[model samples]
Target chain A: MARHIYSCPLRWSDMDAFGHVNNVVFLRYLEEARIDFMFRLAPGDGSPSFSGGSVVARHEIDYVRPLVHRHAPVTVESWVTKIGAASLTIAYEIKDPDQVYVRASTVVVPYNLAEERPRRISAEEKLFLQEFLAEEPAAV
Target chain B: MARHIYSCPLRWSDMDAFGHVNNVVFLRYLEEARIDFMFRLAPGDGSPSFSGGSVVARHEIDYVRPLVHRHAPVTVESWVTKIGAASLTIAYEIKDPDQVYVRASTVVVPYNLAEERPRRISAEEKLFLQEFLAEEPAAV
Candidate 1:
């Protein structure tokens, strides 16, 4: 099981009046990490990329504790939880060096650009994601 | 009931690789609208002005559709859903004027800054919120 950890700087706007990182901002952090992971592993330049499709899906997030905005950086850990025939479940945990801040999971379904609808996960994508899919709690 | 409709500009950073506003970004929009509403109604100097001590308890958002990043502005419609002894539910709808984009709801609980725990909703706050909470839904 391979895990990708991406770190991002906390901008001043990320904080709320409580002097804590606004809850919604966590999603943006997760998105950046996930996109970086995909680009690194897949490595393609196109609308749908080498997989011949795009991905879209839903997400669920649970806030574990408040994160204070500080000069310190935040790290996001992302991994594929499950890989379905046409969709994949990815799980994420955002934390500082000491404690966890939030846990989130998303379901991404492959989309066919030509048909403009969801398509089956390609063999190449499955192979590429195999390293991530093999480890820990299976995808839901 | 006084309903506030806020139109916010979409920043380039708000769009993901999919060319749509990332799902997580929607939450920030909601926060901005909530803060603005609070300040407009309460009339404060905008220094983390929720002196009443309120925190978000739960949030549920439905992605009715995707919002593309165009030059057009996005509108966020917000109103009080229900007010309880210690909690209040605020509902929101994000649209592009041409169509419905997303619907979200959040439950906020009053907190005791001194006690470090949630407290009962104040009578004054409830009374102030009543006028905005009693209105029926708009004809979308």
Candidate 2:
């Protein structure tokens, strides 16, 4: 099993009136991490290809602790937890160097843009995802 | 049970590469609706009051359909699904005039920001929340 970790920068606008990172802002951090993971598998060129795009069908997030504004960058650890024929699950851990702030999961379906429908993961794409697969459960 | 529905304007930046609302942007819409619902309960007059401030402890979202960019506003319907001693639940639906796009729930904990701690819902606050209490389950 392998993991892909991304370092996400924090912007001042991410904070709410309470001086903590707004709960909704965490989703953006996770999105960046997921995009990084996917692109790592198939780097985007200037043109489109047969590589299937994906859409999030579901998301679950548990906030372990409130993340206050800080100078340090946050790390988002993500890995594929399961890969069905047409969908896959990605699990994530968001943390600063000192503490974990969130644990989350997203269910993503392989999508066909031209057909406007979901499609099964190609053998090649599934092999690519296997490189970052984790044996652990999708949620904590 | 009463429900508070908010009309949220869509920003161009909210769209991702897929030409649809990014999965993460939906959280911001839900947050906006939740804030409007709370402020309606206890309008802020520049002073602190016992109508406790809240923090999101968890969020679960199911994407019923992808939302495409449009000129019209999106509607977010929010209601209080449960109120415990120190925490409450908010359910939401994101939709346009024709169809539903997302169903979501957020678990929120009442907090005393000045004291930096979770606090019980005051009797008055509890009574106010009862107006929006939803007898149905949190999500569809």
Best by lDDT: 2
Worst 10 residues of 1 chain B by lDDT: B42-51
For model 2, residues B1-140, the per-residue Cα lDDT tens digits are 78888999999888988899999999989988887777554444233533446788999999999887787899998888899998888888898778899999999887778888888876767877888898655456
Docking class of 1: acceptable
Candidate 1, backbone clash total: 3
True interface contacts reproduced by each model, as a fraction?
0.18, 1.00
Model 1 stretches with alpha carbons more than 4 Å out: A1-3, A42-56, A70-72, A112-118, A127-140, B1-4, B9-18, B42-53, B69-72, B80-85, B96-98, B111-118, B128-140
Summarize candidate 2's per-residue lDDT along A49-118 as a digit string, tens digits: 2244778999999998988777778999988889898889999999877789999999988777888998
Cα lDDT of model 1 by residue, A13-52, tens digit: 8887777777778877876787677655664535354345
lDDT of 2 at B122: 69
lDDT value, residue A50 of candidate 1? 34
lDDT value for candidate 2?
Answer: 0.82
DockQ, Cα level, model 1: 0.28
